[model samples]
Target: MSKMLTYDACVERIEQLREKMIVTAAQKGMHDPLVLQYSQELDRAHNYILFLQSLNIDNLSKT
Candidate 1:
């Protein structure tokens, strides 16, 4: 089975997305539609991080 994503990993992904989006916007202009798409993707990643952090991980121990 695939390993579950941790909150820290999600945060790192969000940071990476932000850096890439900035560089893309710089090259393509701020009004580019791709920038908005990237922003929405980042928001979704952030929400996933929050969801992971809110879970009661202690209850997920292996049998």
Candidate 2:
């Protein structure tokens, strides 16, 4: 079985994915649907980061 990824690893992967998406979109001169989809995904990643930060805050309060 595969081990679960740490939070830092997940964030790093998301960053790499975002970078790849940006580069590909720019290279292909993509517009409309593809661009919109990537932008939405990037936004979702940002939201995930915010959620993680909130969890950190909760952890700090418990300590």
Candidate 3:
């Protein structure tokens, strides 16, 4: 089973995966449709995760 990670750690891991995907896409030529789609999806996921993290911080501040 995978170990649970903190928010910051999860963000870092996502960033690393994003970078690897970018590099792989570049090597394969960014013009590939699947590569472009995957990149966009990853960007959306990262943004959503960051937004969630921000909300958590805001909630903590209110308490």
* Candidate No. with top lDDT: 1
Models sorted by lDDT, best on top: 1, 3, 2
Off by over 4 Å in 2: 1-6, 30-32
lDDT of 2 by residue, 1-63 (tens): 033445686588678768867887887766756766777766766667777788889999999
lDDT of 1: 0.79
lDDT of 3 by residue, 20-48 (tens): 67887878877877677667756766766
User: Which residue pairs clash in candidate 3?
Assistant: none
TM-score for all models, in order of appearance: 0.71, 0.66, 0.58
Native-to-model Cα distance after best TM-score fit, residue 1 in candidate 2, in Å: 22
Off by over 4 Å in 1: 1-4, 56-63
Candidate 1 structure, TM-score to reference: 0.71
The residue pairs in collision within model 2 are none
| Model 2 lDDT on a 0 to 1 scale | 0.71
Q: Evaluate residue 37 in candidate 2 and report its C-alpha lDDT on the 0 to 100 scale.
A: 73
Candidate 3 yields a Cα-based lDDT of 0.72
